[model samples]
Target: MSSDFQNVVPDTEHKGLVGLLPAVARPFAVLARFDRPIGWWLLFWPCAWGIALAGGAIDRWDLLLWLLLGAIAMRSAGCVYNDIVDRDLDRQVERTRSRPLASGAVSLKAAWIWLAILCLIGLIVWLQINGVAKLVALGSLALVAAYPFMKRITWWPQAWLGLVFSWGALVGWLAIVPEFHWAMALLYLGSIFWVIGYDTIYALQDREDDALVGIRSSALRLGDNVHFGVLNFYLMALSSWAAAFWMLRPHWLAIVTLAPISLHLLWQVTTLKSADGDDALAKFRSNRFAGLLMFLACLVLGQAG
Candidate 1:
């Protein structure tokens, strides 16, 4: 990988596919971040978690597939919108300077058209869900629309991202289980902390560039205590998850299901190299698997209870 391509953040997997695209379509593909499946995976996990923990994993397999498609389309749309809004800021940051919009590979008008296309796909997925889930998913639009500007005004934009990205949990829960439960709220809350923790790792890659460009991030905010901050954030995530499990099952054994993910997160914190941008990126990307582990935990508890 060249220095330029490294700017793509989690440039670990399937990146070679982008190189095979034709010049005309390559910019749009990059703009949508289609090469980086990690974003959609992160988005999809919370939705799956919601469905599984809400006791819809088996009969709701169709809904799971539809929601997965929705995550991909909407995550892509959000990236295009963010690029359109933050083209200037993206250019100032070396890590993002090569992005389609910032590099002038894709014009703003074309990006908007592509964003609309992605949203069309998202709309199709949205229509497949129940009215309750539709309304719940729709509520996330305001948070998504405002995300690009968050770094400009707030040091804790990651918290806002938590609210935005973790919203799929709510939608997934409502898809089949519309009844309110404290377990659902606790699951969503724990997911917020999970997002904050992983995104802080992602932010580590841009710390220097962000400082130079006046873009705020939790990684920058925590400074040298980044390790400690993420540790606590993940701890909060596990504790909240444990509490959620208790609410659903009231069994001590349910907490045991969380051990794998808890250990995985501890591994991430224990071995993280804060000064190594690439290491930080690898740690952040590892959450895809962490999300899987969480789904397994949710599956166990959801089915058992």
Candidate 2:
């Protein structure tokens, strides 16, 4: 791992898609985390949830594609921005020591340039959405800008990340309708809790390293109660989503739409191995499936209901 990142970063997928790129391009890909599809998937699902639950139209499936591209670009830009802000801190953490910036595989100038390029892609996505959705998307920038510093001031940085990530719900809903709806707000709220739960699971991997570096996280805040805490957060998410479904369709059938994802989240918390970093990572990654299930449920509610 000679500052080249050719050997793969610890937390990244081993020899995954990034490896297929050329040598010089590899570092940039890792910088934006192109190797990790999970990041973008998590971001995109919330947008899909907003769209589908807002009454998905067949023609608007194109919007899903645009939103997915937006998710990839924006999530990558956020990762680069976070790495730039956290590069020194990353050096102190074992899991992130080999990150492109931390390892000097990518320079600050290059990283910033890469971030701008990613944002350019996001700008292209902005052209596809309606005016109100664009404004909603803009509102997330402040949250994104401040997110890297959250660990310095609060134990609930994941909550802030929740606010930032779940923002796509607002964008998705607003894209469909010019006005706000209570159901959309609940969907967004549920997504916030969902992010907090999964990201807390993600933070479990960095617990020791984070404490050593004085980085605050929900995992550290909860300590022994991490499992219970995650369970409660998931429950909140499910409850909020159930309420959302009920509001949208006002039927027992709509509530039934959420059963699969609810059971999947249950499996995650119940089977979670809080002591093992690998298990924590697996549980965190499991959110991709959870997001998919949620999307299907929202799709069913919006279209079939």
Candidate 3:
């Protein structure tokens, strides 16, 4: 369908409301993904994991709210920045051509203004955390700022994004407990691989266009064996989480509680179809549920311990 039809059709009828938002905002709202909440959820999960793992007698409802806001704001800002940098490449892709910045609906300058506003919101949220968490959050800015350039320079841009997206694990953990814990660090590292595995699947959606435009991605790097590569990454993610769990809880039940999450990742790998881009995207989006399951596992174990 043309952008005209896409915009006129109410997003209430669409499966992906986010794409609709960019289409309707006369394209400006795309800067904030008011249309897409999945990115925020993906961004929010690590923070949730950190918060849950840091469980004590502490109530952090206020901090959680701030993190949620920050997730939405920063995720939107990151998307806007990415669109601006990749506008040319985006226009070449079927799925992304209609994006605000790529489609000429929103200018680069306008998008930058929107990005700045979102960053301010993120900064406010950062201030709400402890000094250590604040520093950790600040450290992520460089990663966020440089992410748009990664695809141009490396075939593993998704790996870089894993680092950027999972930084919240550290920030959220340090917020509740100022001390460093190797177990938490391992968990965060595991989450990073999970992001890389899923995001690589997402990147497959544009692999054709990406290659045509000289954009590098793990999907293209892995080539026909992309499925195997993704499987290996997921296995690594599961192993990392297992190590973290053993370190933190060191109980048979804690390990058993994580079975569901590992099985879910296994299900995704065994059933996934890399030849079909839509299939890859659907599988990738399903990680939101995967993250939730893992978070629940962490919450249950943390409370029990």
Candidate 4:
């Protein structure tokens, strides 16, 4: 592989398809972050949680599959769009300086084209759902499109991301039930805090660089108190999720189902090394497992008679 293809940040250690693809195709793969399956997994989990909690997963597994596909495609599309919009800022940040668009390995036109292709795939996934779900899914586009600029304007871009990333919860619930419920709303809200918590962990990797570049983030905003902030966010997430579970099943067991994830979040907070970039990345990636724990909690609660 050429040096250009070798420029991916250290955080995404596994090159996967990017490693196997011809050098000419490597930049596009990086742009879509196919090498980083964690992004898609984080995005997919909220969709899965929504489906399971809404009682759709047992009978409508196909819908869960479609939402997963949508998450991968749309997450890729969002990354491409973010790269395009933040190329200048990315060039200034150490971790992002080597991104395809930032490093000039991929041109603006090509990046946009790749984004379009991903969006087209997302559209195909969107078409698989009902009209109301389609509408709910479409509602996320504005949030997605605005996200690249949030770091430029706010200290809490992660909050905006919380809204964007957790949207699948809403879409997943609506895809099956068609009507809104307070439980779904609570699930969505809790997922938002979960995203905020995890993404703050992710932002810790770029804290110094982002500060130097005048970019705002929760990690930077919390400064020395980042770990405390994360703990608070995680606690809020668990509280909200517990409330949602109780609303759904109204049983002690439903709350107990959340114990595993609560412990997992506790482990993440306790083990986190805030100033260590590699540790931050590992903790951020661990949320994939956190998502699974939540899904099981939702599954158990949703399945109860």
Model 1 residue runs over 4 Å out of place are 1-12
Tell me the TM-score of model 4.
0.98
The digit string of per-residue lDDT tens for model 4 on 216-240 reads 9999899989889999999999999
- Per-residue lDDT, model 2, residue 13, is 72
lDDT of 3 by residue, 1-305 (tens): 35463553132123245454433453666545666677998999899888877773147767777888999999989988888888888777767777777767778888888888888998888788889989888899899889999988999999999999999888888988888999789888998899999998888778888888788999999998887988899888888878888888887887887888888888888888887876887888789899899888878766766
Counted clashes in each candidate structure: 0, 0, 2, 0
Q: TM-score, each model?
A: 0.96, 0.97, 0.91, 0.98
Determine which window of 10 residues in candidate 2 has minimal summed lDDT.
Answer: 1-10
Q: Please, what are the lDDT tens digits per residue for candidate 1 over residues 147-225?
A: 9999999999999999999999889988878877899899999999999999999999989999998999999999999
Q: What's the candidate order when arranged by decreasing TM-score? A: 4, 2, 1, 3
Per-residue lDDT of candidate 2, residues 195-276 (tens digit): 9999999999999999999999999999999989999999999999999999878889999989999999999999999999
Residue 36 of model 2 has an lDDT of 84
Q: What TM-score, to 2 decimals, does candidate 2 have?
A: 0.97
Give the higher-lDDT candidate: 2 or 4.
Answer: 2
Error of 1 at 165 (Å): 0.8
Model 1 whole-model lDDT (C-alpha atoms): 0.91
